[model samples]
Target chain A: MKKSSCSLLILVLLWSNGVFGQDLLNLLEAEQKDENQYAPSAFMMTRIAFGHSTEVRPQNVLDVFVANRFWNTPEESTQSFVADRMSSRIALEYAISDRLTFGAGATTFDGLFDAHLKYRAALQRNGDGWPITLTLFQNMSYDSSPIADQSVSDDFSDRLSFTSQILVSKRFNKNFSLQLAPTLVNRSLGLSAADPTSIFALGAGVRYKLGPHVSFVSEYYQVFNPLESRTTFDPIAFGVNWELGDLMLQFMLTNSWFMVEDAFITRTPNNFNFRNPNLNFGFNATYVIHFKNKLKK
Target chain B: MNKVLLLLTTLVLTLSNDSSDKVICRQGSVSFFSYTSVENIKAQNNQVSSIIDFESSKIAVSMLMNAFVFEKALMREHFNESYIESDIYPKATFEGEILDFEPAMEGAQIRIVKGLFTMHGVAEELEIKTKIEKSGSTFTLTGSFETLVESYDINIPPLLAGNIAKTISVDFRFEYEPYEEK
Candidate 1:
């Protein structure tokens, strides 16, 4: 009887061990045995108007945009505040990889052709993280406008302009986001004797989501011209961003009509103050195409 | 009698060493559908992990919250940032037992599994009807279930509630291979 009880005891002990040992083989242990934590999709788009957001398209995706800014300014030829405007921009942006984006575009407003390189430097996982979704946007534009100002000799190299800006944004919640950009626009051609070529400006943008597909966006840029004698205009714009399947449409009311950053930052012609005429209207459309749906996070 | 005792010991050892009772699936698929008067949204995650121990009648499945891919990027973002709070709870898991299940060497079995499903740090009891298929060395399990978003503490603001279904439909499939000792 003693031997029988000992044998029974060993059987129970081993059977219980087998049952419980397999129970400990949880799914989490077997999956991703040596993988790192997954990366999160921080933002939805590559650009927020003139300001480049920290967001980037997936690798091998191309974005085509046609942004139009039509302003009814008093035509210098007729001196009439009429809708006598034809200005538009066509741009193409491609995400070479997850972290880098290259773009080339042309704007007829200021007669400029520009190319830009955008690099995402940091991502804001959560909270008031430093360098939250910061992106460096560098653009070089060649102004091709006719030398209308006959007072000065037109230097071919003077038409070149370079813009460098750092866009910093934070998504406070699903409904609200804010972006700030410190910009420097360098023009080889100065407007006046006192007008310095290097211009400094601060840009602020806000996005409030009305729904999953629509958002209210506003952007403002404050320009500080170093030369006291040179007058600079600050541009303010409000718009609605509507998203379709793979397309996005942004309709705007603004005081500036120039579509290129080099033309508008501090050199905008339309003033927003009550003393000015009226706000002009504009529209921006973006369509993104994925060449390969290999977005692995 | 000693021979009988030694035989009993061998039987116990063999039972303990038997691994055919367990199965593992590393690439299970899970999808959820939300239908509302305004729109219908769907997402799928194929990186789901599942493990089943037939001896214990235990089933467990785990999937990363962000693993679900949607047709719309913005909707996916809202799911992670607002609805799921994926950073706080990065994964969803369910562990349960199949009711009155017996191992059939070759055949399909319909079983009911009752377990606790947890998402966004909220846990709720769920009962799922599963269709399990056995073919050669593979076992394919498919099932569907329905649950309320509110049951898991997923809050949709009144403004958005009209556009998002309160009741969500979840579907899962797993092709499990017998667990092998590494």
Candidate 2:
């Protein structure tokens, strides 16, 4: 009887082990892991309105941008409608990696060609990890317009201007974001005698998301020292961004006519004050195409 | 002395039984497709985790939503940020029993599985017809099912309503190996 009881005990132990061992769900939970949780949708596009935002394109993606600005001065009577002068820009931007973007563009306003390289230094986290997103932007522009003024030199090196900026942005929530860009501009030939060889300006931008596909954006640039030889006003813009499938459109009213960073920040002649508004109507359209295969995370 | 030998033998058998009951799959594949008049959208995720218990015929699967790769980067962004809200709910899970299944079956056999599928913080009862095969100590499961977008509380904007279908088709396959603690 003792031997039989011992055999029954062994069978019971073996059978119960299989029935009550670790659960399948618990085993799956143990093997499941998490990837890095980065914040999403800081800004819809690479640009908030008229300037670069702290956003970069994904790797091996191409972005085509077409921008047009229309403005008319009350002093010019030759104009039939609101827009007597128009300037346009066409640009192509590509992402070389997850953190680096390169772009080149041509502008009709000053017969200028511009190129830029942007690097994303750090990205914000989804939670209490990282507080802000940081990006570095560098741009170079060459002016090829006919020498209309004798003071302006025709030397190719003299016509070149450069801009370097550190972009810092914080997305407070899904609907609101703010950005600040401390900018440095260098020009061999100044816009005016009072304009220094190097200019310092602070740029600010804000976005309020209305929906998943639309947002209201605005930007302003404040120069440290005003130009004395020619009257200049700080550049200010208000715009709305609308995103459709693969295309994004920006409708804006601004005081800056030039599309490049150096010219728009230092040489804007119009003021955005409501009393004597010198706002130019601008429209920008961007379309993106993927050139590489999708990579799994 | 004989009782002591029986007790030692019982402990060894119990440990062996526990190890043999569980199997795991680290690289299961799950893909979904949506067909509309405007376009066909599809995505696939290969890094799915799954485990099955032979003793109870229970299975469980877990997957990260962001791991799904789409043909277009923009579409992937929209799927995560706008539709699925992957940031808010990062993972989807399912746990259920494989009914009418024989682990000792030599070849592929059809089985019915009923489970609770959870995604986007919403849960629904799901039933799938699967073809299961057991060879040696390895098991492979293949199945397909249809799920409604509205049932998961996913909202599509009016403008993109025509671009997406009401029902999405999902197909999955998992090849499982005997589970061993790493």
Candidate 3:
């Protein structure tokens, strides 16, 4: 009887080991498979944009005339004098982390060079149960012309201006998104003496996606200058962006033909200020290409 | 003694029958790809997540929109900031199953899978023909499909009308393990 009881205990032990061992193995296998699944949180794209805008305020009329005189001959040429305009802008973006990215780009038109650096931080993500994003951006620019030195003080010539904008965006669906940004602009230029209280600006933008590769965007910004009474600096822009796989293109219409960095930082529309008019209207084109690096899990 | 021997034989037969009817896979992996074209631009996300369950034929997946890295970091930034609104809709997901998978075995075999894909908070029905294979305790599945942006209410701007493609292609691969009863 003692020997039989011992044998029965051993059998029970074996059965329990097999049953629990299989259960533990399955759980571990499931966890390992989950970890093995590659979920990339960062991506890259080539961005290019050609955009033009027109100023509608009365104060812009004189500025428009000066711009027209600079770009066109005084004669009434039937060629339809195109005023202030910009060509194409090209930029590259790199994801620094799951929630952060850094970017830089150059815009060239006529004889101007504008370069800028930008950083974007994702404050909240949609899947996190929030349908909104709050982003902060800072950008700066430099002019490569001696005339820029003569027209603006040395402090503003090759200086970095700061514009802090808070973007609140909501995705209504998979294809449509809209955002509103309220910004504060601080210039190193002599604007402190000329227009001390005009460092604040209000802006809003909207994006509508038509497909996997096509989207439309529109933005409007208004700047208030304390030095100039009854006349606010406002610029409105409209553009479309397309994605063809590895390549992308952007076309736009706006009062500011400056590079995106300049458009927001300097608030200079079409390279012309509120002092110059000519309904600055022009287009920009940009192209992007990507190289991928894959890491082992 | 004869009766006891007969009972032992019955118990052994039952255990063997249960073990032989089921197959098991131990280690598996899953991945996905997304291709999007807008206006004069084309972009793709090559790395995505995938999940598989052989016993239930259940699958699950998730992908980050910001993961669609571009050549230009600025463009990628704008894509997340201005275009896809990644912060507002950061991830896309899918949950579904393979139907009638009893015949799946240890070689490349084609099977029909039908399930629901939820993106941007909208759920849509999807049908895909997946290739399946079993090798040394591992099961693999691969498939591809296209989704229209409009069906999900994704709006493409008129200015970028020429750059983006109306349909986006998605590809996936998944490997699964055996189901163990607790």
Candidate 4:
């Protein structure tokens, strides 16, 4: 009886192994046909947007822009430009993981700072047939100036601001995707009575694929401050992203440009006198290179 | 009973024959190109592999989603987290076979492959041209194809539409060694 029972167990084990093996094999075959058939060596995208909105009150139209004159021309001065009536910024993004990314950029009218850090985390994915993504982002800005003057009390300083945003995006098709982010802003320093670190902002953006190497992007953001009576700021931007093998270029335009905290945060046109103020209009450009490591699969 | 025996015998022979074919794929430095004019932005997956059994019309392929490195690491992260959701669906696979395969010389030859490809939980019929090369104790296979992201329900954000390509092309080359039969 013991021998018979042992044989039965062996038979069952063999049968189950065969069944499961076949199932696994079948699954493997099926999965091969799915999207992204190859284990990609790496993925990258360069983005840019350019757009502008006029202030509702003509006198309130303040544009802040920061320009890098020495960027493309060797003879150009290294000093940055400051315009308080209109602005623009250009940024480049890189993906470190499937859910996290790092980004840096420079703006036209905000401040002299030429870089920032952006970390995004995906809380949910649209894998199970649902075309929705929930993501959280933390954007931090650094001061651009080497000189530190506490008396300056400009928006650009040794300060840190945190933005908590929830993003929901849906790909309408392979060529197009749309996303909406509702965010809460918290700042360590308050520059104005109208500047509420706890203001609410809304962001809407879209991505469209045109071909194998190019795409277009656009985004709009509106921030509403409840503490400051009837104070709101709307910034719009549009741009084009070009990918050349390993190199990516992004170019964009806008009316509220600043690279660092003080550039846009303190010098945005909304906070300055609209009339007889500096108005700057220009584009921001970014280039990126990717490095990849091979994996043994 | 005779027919059942014959079927079992054929299955055994086919299985044994497949054990002799192997396929390996690798991607070292893959790249992506995004163009606004041609609207041809594409991320190329360099690491891809698969094995095929000509006698049985069976095939298997596998890839690591995280392996897709990008020029901008941030974009890679967003793709894994926000787009492909790499944590939940870490890898993509295909398990199917050529509908009709006839054994040929032990070297490279052109062959037609037909099978069902499942992606993003949806399965679709795929007919592609494949090259099979057999050299003594080794075999190699190569194939290329393209797929529309919409077919798999991959959504691109409107703000990002201009940067991502609608159709992604897939190219593959595999090297295999015989699996010694016991």
Candidate 5:
């Protein structure tokens, strides 16, 4: 009787494995088509702190961005509750295609107007498909600040600057991502006669996700060759990003006073030191709008 | 000796029934719509997989949560990251039996499909009214159902609660061909 019961138990187990309804579902799942899944949210927004990340706005979408920086001068009254000076930048960015994005903005402190074109060359996949994301960025800025020197500010070409960068990024996991940007800057006329017309810099950025809607972001740019005529320091910023439904808000601290890449990456004069009170409190807000239905199956 | 023979015969019958009575759909479509005063969001996934077993009147549906395509890319990102948390629960599935389902039904027949629908690591019993059409060797099944967002443990923060609907409507269609193991 024991032998017969043992054989019966074996039969039941084998039958359950093949004949159960769950097995049918498993079979269907096994034959499901393999779909390409791309890594999502390498960076929460287009800007990682003060520098641009390897992210492009979606096609046919418009982004309205506003950034502000506030700081106190050394001679400012200590009685003031907060910073005494403020700088702001307002921008409108639009994605023409899935891989191409363009934006233009105006800044208040330097009276600078800037425009940029970004192209996404490659996107990282979820698994082992593509290890890194690659993007190319080009920006042009015109200084519109009122200057007494006619030779410096009168000519449109002399007041212009250009920046070119290749942004390479990798999303190691859902919570961490890293990016490196090799940059080249060109100025029609340097601020000082001894300053070089061209500058080379390397920027690094990191994002650590704390939650689905929040992340800690930091960026640093190191100039290869410093300006000979003026004291220049590398730009560094750290911030927290909060994402709402259609808007993103970033709060940051940085030693750079400028908003645009042409000015900040090459001309930042303050060092990010613990003892120095050079850090500026800044915030950025971005709103996105989708123009039309561009869904792809 | 007779008992051993009986066990072997039952195994052979079950294995043969698995292949002969099954129909499969590799390219099915499932779409969901959320209507709200603030915004109306809609997404669709065409890479759904489903199977129907006529011998047992059983049906199964499986789809990748990340496969859903929304009108806006940001909406898709939010759906995966915030709403469904696709990293933790990558697939949504349904396994159920068809009531009064006849493989030899002449024309379009309306049937009730009762199943456990699982999404976002939560499972709930569901009954969907489906329209099934059989012509030659092809079987087409189409249906729509309404499910509450709360039933799936999907939490929308109070601040953005007005942007999404409390209840969502889902529609699906599958065209099944004869299953042949490749």
Candidate 6:
């Protein structure tokens, strides 16, 4: 009788395993078709100080931005803290997917028209595998204004400049995230007649949350290129980001009047010494709109 | 040793028999709606899991907090990253008993479920009205309840006080089948 009862239990277990798993498989598959699929935004703000962040917006979402940069540096005299020379950039970005984002803008500085595409290459979870989040950013720009070296940049290709960066970031906790970006800028025609066509730089940024809607953000770039021949100083920025619903507003003290990666990374005008109070005060605002397609399944 | 062996055998038999009285739902669905004069917010999660024991009148449920999806992508992000903090509290769960519940062979009954629902690392006592539909072998349960967002310690800023409702309404439904140990 004991053996018979044991056999009966085994049969019930086997039957239930097959039945339960199969039924659940079917239900899960059916639900997945209509379920929402999305990932988290690593950074709260849209722009990580004149460059794209590792965070990618969700699909079918558009972000419109206005960034104003005042042309001055803190190393100058304190008489002109907020300079009158300001360049404005209006950019619009759309997320093709959770992994890829594309944007285009026009900067008043150098009459630059720029476009960029940033992709989230890999995401790191808290486990033994994949320790860091990696992102790839590429920006291309064309200076439409007249060039001093007309003989070198007469052609359209000569007017083009590109900046490619690899952003490596890690979210240490809810309050802090750190990022390191190895950047490369390639200009078909260098600014000076004797300058090299390409230059390399390292960029670092940090975001620390102070409240639910406010965070401290900053970024610095150190160029490895020769300082003697360099026409522009390295970029330094310190800012605060305020998030409210779908809108984000940012105010910063920076050293450049450029808002695109190609323009800002290679052509800032300030050093980190802060010898004087001639800091350029700027502000940026971004609003995101979501599009939903519910008419058809 | 012999007594221990006999006791183990008896326990295994009892557990095996209890499996027939135990109902499990792996694809249960839970949703919530918040309506205010200024705005209305809704989210749903279909990956919820629940189990009910007919003999013991016990009910338990668990679901991933990140699985909750909203109609708007930004809302979903805020729901996980801002409000729920899915990274820290990845799952929400509930364990409760049906007060004065008596199993029926093939009928429907109204019951009260008294339990502790835990979300965002906070737990609160919940009492919800539930409708249980039982057939020969299939069982279906549906319920809805109202709770305050502050009970879960989720802070809403004053700026958004008008957009989000003061009280939230939660809804749950599950269809259960006899559980298989394997």
For this target, which candidate reaches the highest TM-score against the unseen true structure? 5
Candidate 2 DockQ, CA atoms: 0.37
Candidate 1 clashing pairs, residues 3+ apart or interchain = none
Task: Pick the winner on DockQ between candidates 3 and 4.
Answer: 4
TM-score of each: 0.70, 0.85, 0.52, 0.48, 0.91, 0.84
lDDT of candidates 1 onward, in order: 0.75, 0.85, 0.49, 0.49, 0.88, 0.76
lDDT (10s digit) by residue, model 1, range A200-263? 9989988887865577888888887744455557878888876664677888888777777777
The DockQ scores of all candidates, in the order shown, are 0.13, 0.37, 0.07, 0.10, 0.48, 0.17
After superposition, candidate 3 runs with Cα above 4 Å error: A1-115, A143-160, A188-194, A226-232, A260-278, A293-297, B1-175
Instruction: For residues A1-297, write the lDDT of model 2, one tens digit per residue.
Output: 778777767776666654443455566767776435677767768998789999898888899999999877565366446567889999999999978999999999789899999999999877777889999999999988887677766688998999999999988877789999999989866465666878899999999988777899999999987566788889999999888777889999899888999989888888885422377888999999888767444
lDDT of 2: 0.85
What digit string (tens of lDDT, one per residue) describes model 6 on residues A1-297? 667667766665666445433443343333333433233455766566656678777788899989887654334355664564678888899989878999998888678898999898987665354667789999899888876654554578888899999998877777788889999999755456666668799999998888766789998888887333555788888889888778888889887767877667776655544343236777999998888631223
| Residue A241 lDDT in candidate 5 | 90
Q: After superposition, how far is residue A249 of candidate 5 from its true place, in Å?
A: 1.3
Residues B129-161 of candidate 3 have per-residue lDDT tens digits of: 988887766677777787887787665557655
Best-first order by TM-score: 5, 2, 6, 1, 3, 4
TM-score of chain A of 1: 0.79
Estimate, for each residue in A1-297, the C-alpha lDDT of model 4 and write its tens digit. 667666655665566446433643553444344543222111123222432110010111111222231111123343535432444454555555444555455544333334333333332223444345455555665544333556645555435555555665665544566777686666545345655656676777776766534567777666655445344345555556555423445455544444433233223443322223222233444343444322222
Residue A208's lDDT within candidate 4 is: 75
Listed for each candidate, the true contacts retained, as a fraction, are 0.04, 0.45, 0.01, 0.10, 0.48, 0.15
Give, for candidate 5 chain B, the lowest lDDT window spanning 10 residues.
Answer: B9-18
Sliding window of 10 residues with minimal summed lDDT for model 4 chain B: B22-31
Best by DockQ: 5
After TM-score superposition, the amount by which residue A209's alpha carbon in candidate 2 deviates from its true location, in angstroms, is 2.4
TM-score of chain B of each: 0.89, 0.90, 0.68, 0.75, 0.93, 0.90
Tens-place lDDT per residue, model 1, B1-182, is: 66666677776667557767778899999998889878788888999888887776888888888888876544556577657878678889888888987756578989999988888898899999999888987889999999998888775756567777888999999999988756
TM-score comparison, 2 vs 6, better candidate:
2
**Which is superior by lDDT, 3 or 5?**
5
